[model samples]
Target: MDLREYSVFDIMGPVMIGPSSSHTAGAARLAKIARQIAGDDVKEVQFILYDSFANTYKGHGTDKALVAGIIGIDPDDERLSHSFELAKEQNISFSFVKSDKDASHPNTVRMVIKNKSGDVIEVLGSSIGGGNVVLKEINGMSVEFTGEYETLITKHIDKPGIIAMVTKVLSEHMINIAFMRVYRQLKGDMAIMVIESDQTIPEDVRIRIEHIDGIEKAIVVDSINKA
Candidate 1:
């Protein structure tokens, strides 16, 4: 193993309320990020659990963790244990269903969330042990990003110069890009750009990026594990 790529926290694990790191802490983080991606007006949520997550969720506290996350509770929050009550109090309905479909990871879940506006979003993610997680898909578009950075997501028309123009705006703001990915379902169609930056992109900068021609939406997810 390349020890250089691992931090002390990777070995020691995160400070969280957990009986199992993958099922509890990681599940919470994954659901929390999914909630963030889906926006705050979420009215209802359905968790389609797969593989190990499906087999052992309730026993391992993954059920509570996932509920806690959808209601904006963090893994380390003391309220994690009572997330179901909190969700009911907040009027956010949720359910968990086990799936027999094959998953890429043992701890995987697909979140189908509906907002009060009736808009729905689907997000797929996995907890890869050690309280670490990765979001793999958004609204059926393939994506890959850990919620460890101040990440920016943009949905826009797939056209020439779009990426360059967006990058130029970030460059002007002196935001260093740690990672960037672009995905489209077909040629000359809608596309999604995922950018993980070393520094937080200011709201003004994000607004400028969104105003660019062909850009539909620019959403930023603040770093969950800020260094």
Candidate 2:
């Protein structure tokens, strides 16, 4: 059936496993997607919930669902109820914060995840409804993605001509950039680049990016489609 045929209430009403579909199921899915983007072997996580999520998370099991997802629990698993104790047993550290931002979505969540290697990543996402979500930002870029693309997330020194240099390599190799976003922390000194593409980045291109003058690091996030 075409999703558009369903009314918002019709779509959201059948999802009755939680306190609120947007707050609970959507929150769980958002956390799961963030975990997928952050990769496995995560050692720690921090979840910040906004507005409605903040107010009802504990009662709705949104907190447990988020924690369960980071600990690698499947969303439909009955073990989600024990996720916190499981995390403690597994030695995975986690914390929660509530942010009441007037500008944020009611079901928005910001997750900071750290892998065992101490590499850190931050993802901002929102659960729209019917257990659906969109990753709105990563590392401060205004990006709209579903965590289903082969990706490269990089941080570099911001400078003129960097885009041409990177795109040149892809163009030379016949790779297509499906989506690209750049976030600048300072005018010309610090920036992050997140690129989702139609093909896997070759090892040679990865090495070449590391050698580029203004680039700091070019790390390929594993294919979300494959994961």
Candidate 3:
């Protein structure tokens, strides 16, 4: 098997807070995604760890890493060690659960997050050996995207022409779609769309997507090219 050229940081080292990149950095990234999926102010959080993460998280500062992220700390910052006190200051309650079942990846975490509005969302992510992470699922739907690009997430009624409507708007705005994935439990039910693009998605595009006839909710989950 041939190994593709990986990132230089992954090869040498990731200038991060904790000792383990997979547990600490990956856990923090999941928190940033939690903010993206839930909102900035998280009221409650539950992290489910499987495989290696379940056994050694406490020693690696993984728990603190997760708490730091949920409370708005940057993953690379050194303050990740004090995440517990910070989370207490923020009044955000968090819990951890170790899973006995096997996961596709060795370092996987599933989070159940709730926002200030009492809206709860489930996010599944995996730390792929580097400081890099991949968001694998949302709620129960399958999705795959790394936060390296601008991403758009929409929850809509599963029906015809919605894709056309959304993409048309992006096309009009000259946004280049790098990757896209759609997940739905069944036909004619709730659907979720994840579209990663090469440019910053404007607020207008997100609003427009929500306005489409079949769309129920729309939001941009992008971090690239932000001021």
Candidate 4:
């Protein structure tokens, strides 16, 4: 038999401003990551709630938390309660819709965000439980990643040596990769690379990666699970 040790967070959940960890904390984290993927210049956002989230979002303050996150507020921030007003002041429009997805997790929401540049991103994720969340899909591509670590996400053309080039840049910057995954739909098509690093990824490093051949976009997200 294998044994493992659990941290205080595992039992008590994350420190956050919330009535429920799953509904508030986890929802905030998921929305924040979605905004990071879509860029901070988002002009508008649509949150499509599913199952449990659709049924009880307002009561649990999930709607407020989601709005706060997309606009760069932390879960523990006092301002989380007034996220809607903040969004209005920032000129960021948002709407929420109820959706029923078959075979989907109970606490799932899909975010469709459009930036000022007219680029749109669709992100699907779920707050599993206890303030933990997993990103399941980006655009139309299937992906799996947790925003627990400082993450690097890249959109690029799928080709031989592309992975090596990106890794080489990370190695040069002395960034240690804790985990990495690549997702693509078809051969020689567009691909996404998700890298979880043991250290924070600087914005300059992300820019360096973006300038690499075959790379289209690169984004760095700070660890959301950190205390």
Which candidate comes out best when scored by TM-score?
Answer: 4
Candidate 4 residues 96-169, lDDT tens each?
99987652699999999999999999999999988889999999798888898999999999999999999999
Local distance difference test scores for all models: 0.92, 0.76, 0.84, 0.91
Ranking by lDDT: 1, 4, 3, 2
Model 1 residue runs over 4 Å out of place are none
All candidates: TM-score: 0.95, 0.70, 0.90, 0.96
After superposing candidate 3, which stretches have Cα over 4 Å from the reference? 1-13, 224-227
Q: Is candidate 3 or candidate 4 better by TM-score?
A: 4
lDDT tens per residue, model 3, 1-227: 75887767557765678687778887887777767777576899999999988999899888898888778777788788998988888888999999999998988888899888898989898888667788888888888888878889899889999999999999999999999888999999999999999899888888988899989888777562231
Better of 1 and 2 by lDDT: 1
TM-score winner between candidates 1 and 2: 1
Work out candidate 1's RMSD over C-alphas.
1.4
Residue 129: error of model 3 in Å?
A: 1.2
The residue pairs found clashing in candidate 4 are none
Two-way TM-score contest, 2 vs 4, winner? 4
